[model samples]
Structure formats: C-alpha cells, structure tokens
Target: MAATLDGLITFFASHHAIRADKVLRDAGFATELASGPKELSPNCGTALRFELSRTDDALAVLADRHVQVDEVHPYVPRTDAWDRSGSPVRRAKRLWGRRS
Candidate 1:
C-alpha cells in the first residue's frame, strides 16, 4: 500500500535523513528524500517525507534501528500563493484537521 507524503522528518545530519529514507523504504513504508526546509530545521540539508498516518509505526521502526530524529511534523504545503516559492507555508491546522 502506498502512502501519501504528508509528514516531514527532520534530522540533525544528512546521513540520518538518508538512512531514514532507506530504513523506512525497507520496512515497507513510503518515503521521499527532500531538501530540508530551513524554517523547520537548520541542521541538515535533507529531510524525509512520509505518510502522517503511519507516524507511530515509522518512528517505532526508526527507534528499533537506532536511528535518531530531530522532530516529526505534519506538513501540508500551502498551495495558494506560496506554492511557487518552493518553501512551504504552514497552516495552523493539525494533520488530522484538529486545531493546534
């Protein structure tokens, strides 16, 4: 089953991000390697994208493999006016549509 790319995983290093992509993929999770958003994390130049719904499983898998993560965020890039900037505009709404 393929999952939507709706979550962002930030890491302190590019190695961790890359390893996360591989680990998640190998564990049957959908993942993507993307340029790290500076506003979210300034430590690395890379980030891992994954399905927000599978966050718990993903994090557990990473933890079992001893992979360190800086943070996990539910991200839905604003598509209206900020889409062209290549930088995502975060909304106040949470990933599950509940108010944050």
Candidate 2:
C-alpha cells in the first residue's frame, strides 16, 4: 500500500511469479502477490501488483534478474468494494461469472 499499484504483472508459471516478487522487493519496489485476474490471464495463479508508472523500470529489473514475465496489465482491483461487501458477494460473483 506504499505505491499507487495500478499495474498487474503476470507470469506463465508460479515459480516465475514468486521469483519476480522476491526480485522486485529486493530492488526496493513496493509489490504484492495476488491471484492473477481471470479476465487478464489464466496461465498462472499468481501475479505481482505494483505502480504502473514504474513499469518500465520494474520490467528492466526483472529482466536483469532473469525472471520471465507473461504479460503486464493495467489493473486497479476493486479491493475496497470487495472488503465492504465481504466475501459472500465476492464469492457469489466468482461463481456466477463461470461460463458453463
């Protein structure tokens, strides 16, 4: 919560996600590990949340650290709304959001 985390960085694998989190943290960037947004990607279960303005620098750091990234998405999760409504509504939304 130190930065305006408007970006979501996804990975093809969980290891990559974990590594990216560590690497970014070590580089002094604010980050959070969360479930990859279903609307953005389905390859990995984990994703890194950070500020969008520092995306280029973050990507550079990841590259230097040898972390492979699946994609970078501009995402501002509705966590406050979820918190206010609680998990029941969030869970219901997730369940009803299914295709079949």
- Local accuracy by lDDT, each model: 0.84, 0.85
Model 1, range 32-51, lDDT digits (tens) per residue? 99888777788988989999
Each model's Cα RMSD:
7.3, 7.0
Best-fitting candidate, measured by lDDT? 2
User: Against the true structure, whose TM-score is highest?
Assistant: 1
- Give candidate 2's whole-model lDDT: 0.85
**Model 1: which residue pairs collide?**
none
Candidate 2's error at 19, in angstroms?
0.5
List model 2 lDDT by residue over 1-100, tens digit each: 3588889999999899999999999999989998886556678889999888999999999999899999998876656445343444776677689958
Residue runs of model 1 more than 4 Å from their true location after superposition:
78-80, 83-100
* Prediction 1 TM-score vs. true: 0.76
